[model samples]
Target: MALRTRAVLVHRRTELDELLDRHATRGQAEFFLRTRGRTLADVESRHEAAVSARRAVAASVPSDWALAEVERADLDRFLFAPEDVVLVVGQDGLVANAAKYLDRQLVVGVDPEPGTNLGVLVRHDADAVAGIIAALTNPPGRAGAAPSAVRCDELTMVRARLDDGQELRAVNELFLGHASHQSARYVLTVDGTAERQSSSGLIVSTGTGATGWSASIAHDRGGRRLPGPTEQALAWFVREAWPSPATGATLTEGMLGDDGELVVTVQSDRLVVFGDGMEGDRLEVSWGQEVRIGVAERRLRLV
Candidate 1:
């Protein structure tokens, strides 16, 4: 049987929702914000706008298509099917948060607050969602023809896989570090070069992520040029590599071209590997385990 189309609406809780949850009432939330010289009306307006955008997107789904609503906090528990049409209604970070959990689903990024958010990922305005969905679902060709080829940008992604088979993917960057602020000890190998090092951590960022955390690190370390969003290469950095008799910092940073891989042999008791800054959803490796980081074969199909 042919697969049924399902529209998965992804969203994050609004600031007002969070405040109400914490304060237990609207009046209490108002009082809490007022003590900080902030007004509840502003938060309420933004919250209403976000909620309205989400409802609009949800309403835009074709009547025959199955629909599912998922909060960002519950993404790990959500099962995304291959035939699902994912709609992320929020800022770019929310898009990044959903990208790792998806495999081949096409994502429509809806910016509720267009002018306020940096919409690098969430490119479409909320109002455009209805037409976008109609165009994607039912192209203008034949009476019962298949949908036309989707026009999408294949955004590169980074992946970290351990010898034990646990893995994580991120549209931005993968962070390999100690759970705490303590330095992480590991054997770092990149492009056939290996070194024992002690440092804060390591970051392998995709071109999409080159504009964020990795870029800041590169700028602080004498301005190493990074790649663009659609580039196939990845920029990596070893943060604060402490030099000592047993460890070296010479292999500080480099680029991973197509087919290149970075390997890390855990030397500490336990270290973590998390993507896109989601520390809670991570892989932990103990001493003697090896981790491989590279460009993920799966890319985020941003529509």
Candidate 2:
């Protein structure tokens, strides 16, 4: 069969877009920014850059191939095929947000703003998109193919599964905590040993997510540095494990091997499980529900 090169463009709303949506007018949005000591011109320029980058990417897509545009918010509802080549044209977080919805599709992270934004994941510029796509779809050995040098790096992922058969995958980390500001109650189990605990929340993170919230938790608890982004193991921490007569704090920090798993039974009325900082998209576990977390079987292939 012929190659099916489908470019799935992923992006999120800019500050200007959000401002206009909230204030209902460009003038009102400008005034709102000015009141907060921010410049409307800066927001407008950023928005323009993003638009330019998106247009450039759209133009670069091969005319004979398929193309689809999707916003970050609709990722959960979008059905991604196995042959789709995803091109995320936004911040680094957009790449993380898109990873959970994908299986083994090749993803190209395009940095809309090159110099102004520090993009650890969105490393390529818009101008390079055409060449990347060409190389990926048509290898050098194939007929009517171009000389291309596209490559991909594999990144590990974290997977969480509930006893009821619900599942969630995250490129960064998984947060198991109370839905609100109240304390979370759960029984954490590692290596067959279990402990009833009450504290702030539970964070199970892969190596890719170690630089963010997981790093902060590791620093506060004097834990070791997490593995690399492509590593198979995961590190987990219990945030603010409060000691009580009914809840123990002995099992607070540890590493979960590839074959190993960490299990948690909900003692609270409701505990939320979300990945990659997208709290709106989450799995709710009621009291008596069990959740198992481990390194995911799939890995992200970044081209």
Candidate 3:
């Protein structure tokens, strides 16, 4: 027997609802719709779409919980693990990832597009998940790869060392910026020496979040650089010479670490750091406080 069973995971994009069938309970489907100024019928249509898609992938788990307004952290509460090897179907959000990382969890990825998980770090593809399952039940080599299986293409899934000698694996990305919005006066230090933060932010990413925030920071780079290119990690800095985009409560920078650990630096008059936007002990980011990131010695994945 294998150490653990393999599983498959899917994510909910706005269009995920459309992929579902009728008579399916609306599972967080409307939340994916980004269309602004929608109509009543439009809202109903979105709900219908989400329900349909969910049905195609998952059997509805009847529940009386307050509507589809569930938060991302609780996305996986519905799916029933009837078997050792299960497939999680939903959009590419916290819920989907949460299941993959949970105890006794294995991940297999599926998407409408063949290479949908291209830029992102997938735990496993449908084929990989299936193969592991098959290897457990049947034999090896004969088993095929899962449909959602796609190779991850990132640059830096690095292990960065901060001045404190604390090394963290940045599976997605990492960076530092203003702790508070009040005219963030930051000094950048790369490799060891100090630099300058002319802009309002800084960012680092793993292969997972390269497309999200890193793509935004590099937006001015004319897209020459794709997502990630460094298994050792490459860094970027954003310094707004004049004024910041907004004031108080603005996300000055973001750091995407391994295992979906997101570090966002928000600055108003106070410099605060958040873990995946979750509140924590507030601290100020000074030019002296050491900060660093990279890949971790322990690597965890699903699929």
Whole-model lDDT values for every prediction: 0.88, 0.86, 0.39
Per-model TM-score, in order, reads 0.94, 0.94, 0.49
Off by over 4 Å in 3: 1-37, 52-71, 75-88, 95-106, 110-172, 179-182, 196-198, 222-230, 241-270, 273-288, 298-303
Could you tell me which 10 consecutive residues in candidate 3 have the lowest summed lDDT? 60-69
Total clashes in model 2, counting residue pairs 3 or more apart in sequence or in different chains:
0
Q: Which has the higher TM-score value, candidate number 2 or candidate number 3? A: 2
lDDT, model 1, position 129? 81
Q: Predict model 2's lDDT versus the native.
A: 0.86
- lDDT agreement of model 1 with the native: 0.88
Q: Model 2: per-residue lDDT, tens digit, 1-303? A: 655557789999888999988999999998888899998899999999999999999999888778999999899889987768889998778999999988878888998887655466787999988888767644433422323365677898999999999999998899998977469999998998999999889889988899998999898877677978888889999988989899999999888888989999999887899998989889999999999999998888887
Candidate 3 global TM-score: 0.49
Writing each residue's lDDT as its tens digit, candidate 1 over 24-112 gives 99999999999999999999999988988888898898888889999999999999987788999999899999999988788999987
Per-residue lDDT of model 3, residues 132-171, tens digit only: 4433331233222233433322223444344445443334
State, as a TM-score between 0 and 1, how close model 2 is to the true structure. Answer: 0.94
- Worst lDDT run of 10 residues, candidate 2, spans 139-148
- Residue 67 in candidate 3, Cα distance off native in Å: 22
